[model samples]
Target: MKKNILNIQGVSEISKAKQSEINGGAGWGFGGIDLSKCGCDCAGRVTGPLYCQNYFGCLQVYTCNDSQES
Candidate 1:
């Protein structure tokens, strides 16, 4: 783990982070996780600003078509 210095309010502190990879198996190499969409509904009510499906289900953050903006 290396050291990171943060200056807040003119105060300096050190923070350490673990090495990127431990054994090179699913390590912090693929930019963490990329869960596009679990197809879970949020605030299930309005299908306007909110996304849902009368046939399928609630199209969530990474599920609904980004171009289909209300």
Candidate 2:
């Protein structure tokens, strides 16, 4: 059996350029999430709010659930 894995470099730069074009030339910025659309049951799960940060025209999703107090 033969395995072929393609490694692409500098792909991030290309994505950044594309994202900038989509944002109308604006730099990366925080794009807030819609909590109403959140499916997590945050009642007793101690789940924190969804945090998003735009880095190089990419939207990164993160959660601070671990920092929440029980």
Give the winner by lDDT: 2
Q: What's model 2's lDDT at 14?
A: 50
lDDT of candidates 1 onward, in order = 0.37, 0.37
lDDT value, candidate 1, whole model = 0.37
Per model, how many backbone clashes are there? 0, 0
lDDT tens readout by residue for model 1, 1-70: 1233343355444334444333343224644332342235354332421112322354234334447568
Q: What's the lDDT of the predicted structure labeled candidate 2?
A: 0.37
Q: List the residue pairs that clash in candidate 1.
A: none
lDDT of 1 at 53: 34
Writing each residue's lDDT as its tens digit, candidate 2 over 1-70 gives 1122224443333567677776333233555453443342333232333441222122234344657578
Worst 10 residues of 2 by lDDT: 51-60
Residue pairs in clash, model 2:
none
